[model samples]
Target chain A: MKVSDGGTVLAADVFSSRCPSRSVLDHVTSKWAVLVLAALAVEPLRFSALRRRIDGVSEKMLAQTLRTLEADGFVDRVVTPTTPPQVTYSLTDLGRGLTGHLTGLLGFIQTRLPEIEAARST
Target chain B: MKVSDGGTVLAADVFSSRCPSRSVLDHVTSKWAVLVLAALAVEPLRFSALRRRIDGVSEKMLAQTLRTLEADGFVDRVVTPTTPPQVTYSLTDLGRGLTGHLTGLLGFIQTRLPEIEAARST
Candidate 1:
């Protein structure tokens, strides 16, 4: 348990089912969410560009993930009124804060892939 | 793409469906896996103690999560031939390395819960 600067009593025990942090954790660490965050860390990208960069994500899943991240204050969604209505997504300051942590985790796994694969074989 | 000291070529792009690192990332970040790793960070824990610490985890899920972590070389399971077959779970060196990154992420979420909640309401 921790007391926020705002004096709100905060309990972030992910072990506890009642913790609100668990939902945010789930959303941020979801399969597509991680990939999306990693992709956007480089720069803001349009919906089509994001979809292309993230390999196999379906449009529906990508849209949902962006919405979820946006709601969590980790992503910014900008809509422009063009002939086709351009939608671009980028990391919010909060989202940028999380990118390094996630990318570090992802990079570790990538670098250790050989070791992990060897373990899997045996 | 990066190459290990052992001269093994590594491709850890999680965006690619065929990447082995993707599976490792998924297992390590699974809901129970994160909580289990966080719990084990402080000290080794018996099966029952771990179950109790992680509030709502089912016996089956806990067992499965442990096995997955062990297979990934991130967790060590020690079994003792006791009256009830005492088993303790702890982080391996690899697991310990990841603990800081994960706990940092979790701690951030917990501390920022107030802000996240406010964002949700608006």
Candidate 2:
């Protein structure tokens, strides 16, 4: 329908091909995006720490995912003016809200693995 | 850590590269998978109806997504012994559980579109 932001109203429809929400949804649910959100859910982490926490994620993918999340207002990127220029990433309020749902999905999949595997075999 | 199915215990870890849950998670969260699940959440539909409901999904991608969801025990495929053989796809009990979380995520994204767009413009 219509989403009102201050005085500016926007049409919202994920089912539409031209809706921006489609892209936003894709970014938030991307493989690396889910893992990054999961890792950050534990604690805010620097770039290097984030890379280590998620298995099988390349440097480029991680960077791209973070940028997409940041642009969507789900991630906060802070730069420390240190000798080495440290940057840490954490979930914003919006990001945390989204992460709660993602965490639930992840937990469901993890706990029900046996049932899922059995389903596959049968 | 451990998930027990009857007497057989399974280790559950999505963070590990070798974990089967990783693949399951991928299937559930895949672009087409999410849309297909969402579409089926309404009611059981045949292959053609499902393809029409989701925008921008190709014939090949729709078939592949349905097969993946079925193999994961999230979808049930029923075929009728008619002249042309009618096939219908619907969510299993397990699929319903996961669909709840996915519907929540999709709703959140749809409702927060304005905020996400504002974040991008800033």
Find the candidate with the highest lDDT and give its number: 2
Deviation from native of the Cα of residue B48 in model 1, angstroms: 1.3
Clashing pairs in 1: none
Give candidate 2 misplaced runs (Cα > 4 Å).
A1-11, B1-10
**What TM-score does each of the candidates earn?**
0.90, 0.92
lDDT of 2 by residue, A1-122 (tens): 37556898767767666778899888988988998998899899999999888889999999999999999999999999999899999999999988989999999999888789999999
List the candidate 1 regions with Cα displacement exceeding 4 Å. Answer: A1-10, B1-10
Assess the local accuracy of residue B4 in candidate 1 as a C-alpha lDDT between 0 and 100. Answer: 51
lDDT of each: 0.85, 0.89
Model 1 chain B weakest lDDT span, ten residues long:
B1-10
Model-by-model DockQ, in order: 0.60, 0.67
Tens digit of lDDT per residue, candidate 1, span A1-122?
35343677666677677788888888888878988999999999999999998878899999999999989999988889999899899998888887788888888888777767776777
